[model samples]
Target: MTDTGQPSTAIARAQDSTALACQRMGDGYPLVLLAGQANNHHWWDRVRADFHATHSTITFDMRGTGGSGKPQGPYSTKQFADDVVAVLDHLSIERADVYGTSMGGRVAQWVAARHPARVRRLVLGCTSPGGPHAVERDASVRRALAQADPEAARRALTDLMYTPAWLADHPGPYTTLGDPDMPAHARHGHLVASNGHDAWDALQGITAPTLLLHGDQDRLTPPDNLPLLAARIPRTTSHVFPGARHAYFEECRAEASALVSAFLDEGP
Candidate 1:
């Protein structure tokens, strides 16, 4: 068992020889946390400790981000899901509960659907199923995402992620927009993978119990997609954080963590 207080890091090799940076801490059943688009393991830093008391939390940098290999583009969510399984395989963990937010949530959908036996439960936050059935973000938000000025883009993302009150109370750098030094190709790859995601048909194949979470005021992924997911995935429970936004998991950390822990602890 890894030391609960400090995380141990390692590299998991993907099928294409790409190296995925992984971290493990805590003890008990495994819980793998997937970061959003362009994000790395640090995405879960705030709430990771909450699961440590009962779960051996595993976090990793997906290909093209953080310490992971930044290979050539055309990355797909399915490929991202496969990379997640590769981490589990490296750790010798046959099955684990998955919690993914935003783009990570989209990847989780593929993970549960394509590798049913490997996932014990699924938690999706502020993500869409993609394709025609999924709701699109507002044009203004899309324009913000496409901004050429990095500072402008970051500011827009920060606004979309957290409310003003929360920002005032907890003023510190957040990884909502991901690494500032990310390679151009990797950034483009992540965008392509996220925008190209389509798991509408695949969601029905997921056998694990699932939980859908969203913020009522979310403008990035939008809350409208939550019910669409709940409708498709079997054995699903959902919650909408009343005044939260894109990063509801962080905005309502205590409550969200409790809901996740309880759901994952339930009998299979």
Candidate 2:
């Protein structure tokens, strides 16, 4: 784990040095927020702040992104789950309310299914069930990302992320945020963690109380898959924000925070 000298952010002290680096925020019942594959811990600033008002929040840079080590990887979602376990062990947290988005959601599913005792609750946002069509990017969009032109892809990706109305009024927020000083690891690891994953049939094994958050205008992970996820997980709740898009959490922070806060507050 590495320290960035940020006041509110504490460097994650991993038990296993080989796992991804991480950071912790706030101080209460630990709530770990795993970022989307290509993104870093900063992605959860709003969400973390929202929870910090009532609960401790842990946000981590996953392996190969942000402050985390990027070992050569054809990384699997299971491996990403293992990375989460490493963070918990690092913090000496027995169990946590885990939250994830997109590729992060896939990792959360793997963790909940395979490491049931490690997770007290699970929250999935703008994610899919890992099927052929559940979360496929169009070839043109994929091409842009694959070519390493995040700036080019930002426009289309951001469009896919927020509702059109929000997009029109708030283009700068996403455009600026997407321009993270992303390392090469972010690009490569994202391709591996996202496109390489296929875990639809594996979801039934997950037993934690789950909340699936989707946006009606989401193109990355369609809202239709919300029910599929809710049905597959034994005990699950779902919320679909009308006219919202993939980045609904960032775009509609207040509403999104309320939904997640209420769900996490519920008994397991």
Which candidate number maximizes TM-score? 1
Candidate 1 segments whose C-alpha is farther than 4 A from its true place: 2-4
Query: Lowest-lDDT window of 10 residues in candidate 1?
Result: 172-181
Tens digits of per-residue lDDT for model 2, 108-146: 888888899998889998887785746465576566544
| TM-scores of the candidates in the order shown | 0.98, 0.87
Q: Report the Cα lDDT for candidate 2.
A: 0.74
Q: Weakest 10 consecutive residues, lDDT, candidate 2?
A: 1-10
Superpose all Cα atoms of candidate 1 onto the true structure and report the RMSD in Å to 1 decimal: 1.0
Which lDDT tens digits does candidate 1 get at residues 3-105? 5577999999999989999999988899999999998888998889898777899999999998999998679999999999999999999999999999999
Clashing pairs in 1: none
Model 2 ranges off by over 4 Å: 1-16, 133-135, 143-150, 167-186
